[model samples]
Target: MDDVTDRLAQLERDDEELVLDHFDRRDAWELGHRLAHVALERALPVVVDVRTPAGILFHASLPGATADNDEWVNRKSRTALRFEASTALLGTRAEHVGFDFFDQGWLDPADYTVAGGAVPVRVAGVGVVAVATVSGLTSADDHQLVVDALREIMAN
Candidate 1:
C-alpha cells in the first residue's frame, strides 16, 4: 500500500476481502451509484460502469467525461474480469514480469488493457461475476477510487 512493491499485495487483498454475499442488478445499481456520487461530490470528470458477464447493470458518464472514458472503462473492465483481478494488479504484475500485455499474446489491445481502473466484483459463492470500472483520472487514482467505494459498500 505504500509503494509499487505493495500495490500488488493490496490489490490482491482487495480481491479477497471485497466479497459480496450475492450480486444482482440491484446491487450493481447501488454500487455504481455509490461510485458516481463520490466522483460527483469531488467534482471528478469520470465515467463509472458496473457490469456482469451477462450484461451491464449500471453505467454513468458524469459531466466533463466523454466517450473515451467509456472506452477505457470497457477495456479496463475486460482486463479485470478476464482474470478476476483488478486492472492495477494485472498491470503491476505485467511490469514485474517484464512483459507488456502484448507479449502475453492472450489479449487484444482493443478489447483489453492493463491500466488500473477496474475491480472485479466477486461473490462469495459465485466468484468474480462482474466488474466496477472508472475512467478519466490517473490510472492509480481511478483504481483506488473504485477500491474505496467497494470498501464502503462492504463496510455497510
Candidate 2:
C-alpha cells in the first residue's frame, strides 16, 4: 500500500481484482440495493448508480443527496466506464503525473470527471461492461462505498 505511488497502485489492483463472470440488470439492481442499504446504515448522503453503455440499470438517491450528486454520478460513471478503471485511479494519476484530463481537451468536463466514486464493472472475458457509481460523499468515501459493496457481493 506504501509504494509511494500516491494510492494509485492499490486502486489499480482493485480494478484488476473486481472482475465479474457476467452482469445484467438483475445484478445491477442487487448491487444498487446493497449500496443503498449500506449508505442507510452509515447515514450516508449519496446516490448510487449502476449502468451499462446503453442505459442505466439501477439508481437510488438517499435522503441527503441532491441533483448535484446526480450530476456527479453521471460524470464519474461516464469516466470510469469509458476508461475501464476507477475514477479514483484517474484522479490520482492526474495528481501524480500532472496529467490534467480537462487540459487535454479530449474529455469534456460536462460528460466526464476523474473524481473518485465510479468503478468500472469488468466482466471476466468481456472487459468493462458497465459502471457502479456513488456520489455525495467525499470522493474517497464515495469510491470506497462502491468498492466495498462490490467486494462483498463478489465474495458471496
lDDT of 2 by residue, 20-126 (tens): 88888888999999999999998998999999989999999999999999999999998998888899988998887778999968899999999899998888989
* Model 2 pairs in collision: none
Best by lDDT: 2
How many times do residue backbones clash in model 2? 0
Candidate 1 weakest lDDT stretch, 10 residues: 1-10
What overall lDDT goes with each candidate model? 0.89, 0.90
Show how many residue pairs clash in every candidate, following the order shown.
0, 0
For candidate 1, the TM-score is 0.94
lDDT of 1 by residue, 12-101 (tens): 777789898888888899999999999999999999999987788999999999999999999998888888889898888877767787
